[model samples]
Target: MASIARPALLRQVCNAAPTRRMASTFAGSSLKHPSPLTRRPMQSAFATPGASRVAAFHASGRRPILPPLPQVVDGDVNKPAPIPEPSASHGSYHWTFERLISAGLIPLTIAPFAAGSLNPLMDASLCALIIVHSHIGFQSNIIDYFPEKRIPLIRKGSFWLLRIGTVLLGISMYSFETNDVGITEAIKRIWHA
Candidate 1:
């Protein structure tokens, strides 16, 4: 078959398309003819005038009159609020410490490999840093899954247990540093073995 030009095809398609118009009809008894209820006022003339429905409710000894609600967009109506978190004051400092410690770990890790061993002070410091980092990670996990509000005892107990474990591990690490190979050398031995 021969191909039709684009413009000619478009013209033929447009010409063949049916024109559609929408039609709407209303009932004879619609708003064009007013109802009896619309012709009369809803409330009595003797009812409280120049008063809101809520005010009228107050006048009738029903609801107590409350102060006007604060507007949504008014800055004063919505004052500068305190942070909603319970420990907001301490949170930023804690986060900064966590970040500083994480940064330190990069150097600490590289130093051990570069030096091929650790001095007693470096060994103990690295051990403490690792323990602290691990404790932070475990504590964060416990906080996420077991909220203090729901299980206060469990949360506190878990944190204390982590602290105890860290201390015990630190003692073991120190003992190894004095009596045997330190952390770096021990890792090297394991890998070589």
Candidate 2:
């Protein structure tokens, strides 16, 4: 009895409605009847009329799992790559500055200990160089981890935070040198203690 009723129910559902509808109801009478392939799906009766499409990942208002890639203009593959404009600051100059700081550190680091006393000027220079080296290293890490193109907000925030931290450290180091025993002296005391 149940097997005979199931086929009757299936037939009713299959023949219930037309697959295609007149477009005059939704679209402004320009299209009389749209083909089944081009017709839009009917909205759920419970869904709001003005509801906007939302991303599945960002539905809960959290950051995206993966950052979006930067847009690149596609060009002819046969064409040769364009030459980049010359800029010393972005190229050799920045690298040269970092190398100089690194090289200066070895001598400045040795001079105070060799002399058995810290000259205030030499100590200050050493401190400044160390700070600059650390800042450069941290800036590189931030750039690598949080790229400006993909995650601009995070990258800018990290940069500003780094700047603030560098400034605070410089101020504190200056105060430590002037107000009390200098960096070398403090390190020596700590080493002996």
Candidate 3:
């Protein structure tokens, strides 16, 4: 589904039951408003201390899984606030990168058809874009599966491993383009054989 559709659905569901008569409209739907009985405190079902950890982790930026770090005993009430890291995936840079990849889909799909005719530069460009695209995708998966806060060593190691692999693959692609047929022509020849 397109990204815009999700927000539109949310809007519809949110505005659907503004009035009592409109509440009946959503009667048979899954997006019905909650009742008073279901308005209890959002507690974990297990009653274990760890059960609420996920909720707390999400509520605060810090992780609840690990023990808290010891604070400095020095009374420094005027201590400056720590600087926040610039977010790569939240602002304009993220949107531009996303759109560039989306636009490149056309070239990625069409270039393979005429692979034998494309120049080495074009082939190398396509290969680099594909590698970068794949790296971004894999990085996202890594971020989701192995967050740095939870597993610092594994996360950093995995990211560096991916970077090294991408560089090696890019070099190999360039060598292949220089020595023999580039990626598109090679794949085309494979299909013919």
Candidate 4:
């Protein structure tokens, strides 16, 4: 009886003042006069009769429950395992992307130079650049969106990037092809000016 009363008293004291007074009171009471709540129950009729066992619960006061572990909550486990950081293979993958883009840009860059020389054949080079860039851009998307074997909604955006890049690149290329000779000579003359 005295043991159980101590917890209740400490609880009250703690509730009243959550300071050194409550901490000291709890420490003093728990060590010197252990509460009944802390004591193990003796074997009794409550132990054998399953229905009567519930009666014991009603008699004893409810104990304050401790907070749950930080990771789990509301029946759903919340912590997702961290994704592994990129590896050496990541460097290789980046290299692959660089190579692809570099290849596409090469023809595109040269087509402009040829156009500035007023070569009508430069239009074909421009077309080649735009087409190859579109094709390579689509391939890059394959690396991104097809890794898991299925097309994710994310891949949908790739189509747009490829289309826009192709159209804009082609238009830029075609314009330079037509105006190359006069534009180049004018820029040269301006530099002399």
Every candidate's lDDT: 0.64, 0.70, 0.65, 0.53
Best by TM-score: 2
Clash pairs detected, candidate 1 = none
| Backbone clash count, each prediction separately | 0, 0, 0, 3
Question: What global local distance difference test value does model 2 have?
Answer: 0.70
Candidate 2 Cα outliers beyond 4 Å, as residue runs: 1-86
**lDDT of candidate 4 over 1-193, digit per residue (tens):** 5536656545534332333233353556445434333433442333333322343457674454842233424334775766879797667796786576667667656654665533445445545644665666676776665543244444666666667877786676567656664333445457779
Ten-residue region with minimum lDDT total, candidate 2? 15-24
lDDT of 3 by residue, 108-164 (tens): 668667545467777777877888788888888898988655677889999999999
Candidate 2: tens digits of C-alpha lDDT, residues 70-154? 7665566686777879887877899999999999999988887798658888888889999999999999999898976567899
Q: Which tens-of-lDDT digit does each residue in 1-193 have in candidate 1?
A: 1114445444423322211011114344234324323322333333424333334335354444653433346357657765666775468888999988888888878987898877777877787798889988998899897666566788899989988998898888778888987788888789889
Off by over 4 Å in 1: 1-89
Task: Judge candidate 4 at residue 54 and give its lDDT.
Answer: 42
Q: What is the TM-score of each candidate against the true structure?
A: 0.52, 0.56, 0.53, 0.29
Give lDDT: candidate 4, residue 154. 46
Give the distance in Å from residue 35's predicted Cα in candidate 2 to where it truly belongs: 33
- Best-performing candidate as measured by lDDT: 2
Candidate 4, superposed: residue stretches over 4 Å from native: 1-118, 145-151, 179-193
